[model samples]
Target chain A: MNSRREFLKLAMAGSTAAVAAPAAASAQAKPKRWGMLVDLRKCIGCQACTVACTIENDVPEGQHRTAVPVYELDGPNGPSQAVLPRLCNHCDEPPCIPVCPVNATFKTEEGAVVVDAEQCVACGYCVQACPYEARFINHKTGVADKCTFCVHRTSVGLLPACVETCVGNARVFGDLNDPESEIRKLMAQHETKGLRPEFKTGPNVYYIGLDDRLASTVAVGGGARDLRQGLETSAHGEV
Target chain B: MPAVDLMSFDHEAVWRPWAVAYFLLVGTGAGAALLLAYARLVRIAEAKGALIVAASFALASGLPLLADLHQPARFMHFYLGSAPGSIMWWGSWFLPLFIVSTLLLAFMTGRRGNAPMCGGERMLTMIVGALALCILGYTAGEMSVVAARPVWNTLGFPVVLILTALMSGAGATMIIDSLNGEKGEGRYMLVVTGAATLVAFGLWMLTDTNLSTLAADYAPVGLFGGFIIAGVVVPVVLAVSAKASLLLRGVSGALAVFGALAFRWSTFNGAQLMSKTETAFYGHEAALSQDALRTLAGSAGLLILSLIFVTLLINLLAVRASKQTQA
Candidate 1:
């Protein structure tokens, strides 16, 4: 009984140390939960973000890192164009991370999901796993590529290329963990919605004034999509 | 009434026909390994043909898979680390081990010169059989875990893959038996498996709303019909009727093998063609580029060569057995 008490005391001490150590470390700096907030009502469908993102990431022609899909929908007034800017959600419970065969894709320390290109086998498993249709196998490099949430600029205390170029100030990005962050403020004020929330992916990217049909799936292919596809195929047949 | 898409890029399928070929060939190989285990257990003389199909197809199955990978050279990354959460990572480990154990079983003869089975050979067969089951499970889990692809996400997808693998492997073994003039036990197994696959798929359609909806909307009449009739029904009919000529046997065998290929093409590749955001499919562009052709050629050639080598080995073993009996 004496020996059992001694063992229990040792176990209790170890558990306390384990709990206290992380708390002490966290005092220095708590890890940031990065997030994006898109205010759809503010967007003008300029395609500036698309063009800027392409230039910033050096994305190939006919492929997208991020693209604004404009849908023609009938509202309370009449038919008007509505835009849903699509990009990698970089979800808290990212489906893409766990599906990677080689453990090449992972969430960074600050909570942005990124792929290690050098280590990637480019099997396209993650590409298929993504519900957002955000990831693609880079035709030039033959590796999985997606929006990194502009980690390059964000880390250096600069806005993402897309955010910087948005004429309407639609794309608001910041650390969700920070109470004073612009994104947190907007999210507090507005009823923000995430795309494909039915999948329960816990998307870090949230939106305001999102249409119900646009959030789920859009009925397409009887309009400009067919013509665009045809022309792209025929025009860029060699590539 | 409908939302018209003014501008959207065409999304190409992440996995192409190369993926379909890999799945079909690998699934067939795993099933053949299972058949080999059963044959060895029952003291069947036709184990070598099953063994050959199992090892050769498993051996050659990696190429198309590598081709499917855009960076085939980086395949070593699969082994450098381990990720338990990933079905694909689990598959990477299961695949190599399965191949090695199968090859070991093939090299160590089961019944030599009509002798009773040796002890080690029996143990190895069981191991190979167990590993074969792992490979089947791994392959099914790898695809079925994709919640994004509604057709593949169903429980029935794995069942159909497994059942089809069993019958297709049986078909392959039967083909070899007919070529060597041996009465194949696979003929009977095929009828059972073919029927099981049909029932499983029918139940799948009824129970799973996602699959039922997808099938209603876009299941191709030609490819899907070909899989049901030519692959399952025709082959099942031929196998049940006894006293079939060698020509018919070979034809059915070929059809069965091709049927497995057709099923993967129509389902695995077909599922990728469907759009998640848009109602209509992102139409298939069937690329016959130099890269695709080269990859297919390389993998198919390896498969052919392995088959030839196994055939010669079988013939040599027969001659040696005859000499021993004469002595």
Candidate 2:
């Protein structure tokens, strides 16, 4: 009995060690952590960023890498609109990463969560795991797909397509690890918030002046048509 | 006037019926395998036919899983590129090992007392049983790890599965053994099925203490009530009755099997109904397209086909062994 207990203990420890080892090693070799800040006060809801992201990523029709969902609230000054653009949070502790059976989805040293198309079995585990609803199964590729934070463009020292094309200059993107970067400066100056903060995923995307309507709306999986109707009729309010 | 863009995340049911069917098959298979191993270890002679059925279920569980995958060809990547932390990765490894080991034990047992399993064989059975437990646990863990889905984010999910697996396994064992119309360990298995069902109910009560959207509204009312009526209440009452005919016992066992399948169906589908976001959640309904329905039918057909195939092969081996002994 004692021997059996000992064996179980050792087995448990070994499994834990195997899962933890890679994450610790990756942290030690830390590169520049890329993050984004969206100033909702500055956004005009032009949706140029959305269109640009789709065009740049060659995303199929009826799918989006980034979305600008606008909400209206009843304000003292009458109906006001708040535009909130949503994208992959690229969490430091991504919920989506560990759920992929085939290691198809992983977080880079630079803090972008990426999907390997070739390795993906399209089991959709990551799609279900994501708290932010950031992942979707790509119909054309028959694999899980999501925003890469435009790693291809950012790695080449070019700004992400969304950040470059934002007409209102609402988006600020840079290496969060660099203290001198614009994102770092903005984060220091402004109190920013992440979507669904309670999940504790350690999201990299920060929002300034996030609208209450957009923030407070409970993500209903199926009963959303009524909510969409409510959003359309209500006047927008300031954060 | 600014356009209020109402676009929310896509309400596509990623798991759908394919995933539901896969979970049911795997759980049933694991439960059956564990029971078979236990019977073999104790040298239950009357359980030979059941052993064959159990082993077949265990091995054939891979069918629904493969059918659910969009890229079935990349199935090998589970071995080559498994993410260690993933519960699905653990499942990928645990399942095949369980199947292979169960098959080996079944082969040894099929020799019909000519060559009984030795110490090494018994050891292998124990190990496979242990692996079977892990496989069942992994199935629950797969859903529980998804922090996004509040309904599936608890340990109770796996506990429910474990209990149901044991219950269903006992039922399947009893039914298969009774087919020959010989007196076998039916009463013992009935008692076991009853006990497991009771424990599962206790666990269900505990699971409902903190109800998430998955457990809220119509879901729990149907799920818990359904389990109680079909799985717990019916089986226990039938098992305890004096005039429990073989036909009645068989019916009780069959209910337990169907109950197990229903549990998986409800759990998987119910969890998907709840949204992950904080805003007004978009309601989701799983569309039962003809294609999806056809695939589901195909998966069931595959299970039956494999059972028939394995039985024939086992019979052939038995005949050959007997002929050689006479020679």
By TM-score, the best candidate is: 1
lDDT of 1 by residue, A1-239 (tens): 01123334545676587667876466427667888888999988889999999999999998888999888998889989899999999898889999998999999887888999999999999988999989999988889999998889778756778887888889888778776667888899999999998899999989999988888767654567667556441222211
Tens-place lDDT per residue, model 2, B170-222, is 66655665565543444466566557656755665565643333444425544
Clashing pairs in 1: none
Q: Considering every candidate listed, which one attains the maximal DockQ? A: 1
DockQ of each model vs. true complex: 0.34, 0.25
**Model 1 chain B: which ten-residue window has the lowest total lDDT?**
B214-223
Docking tier of model 1: it is: acceptable
State which candidate has the highest lDDT: 1
Per-candidate RMSD, Å: 9.5, 11.9
Candidate 2: residue B87 lDDT (0-100): 87
lDDT (Cα, 0-100) at A76 in candidate 1: 89
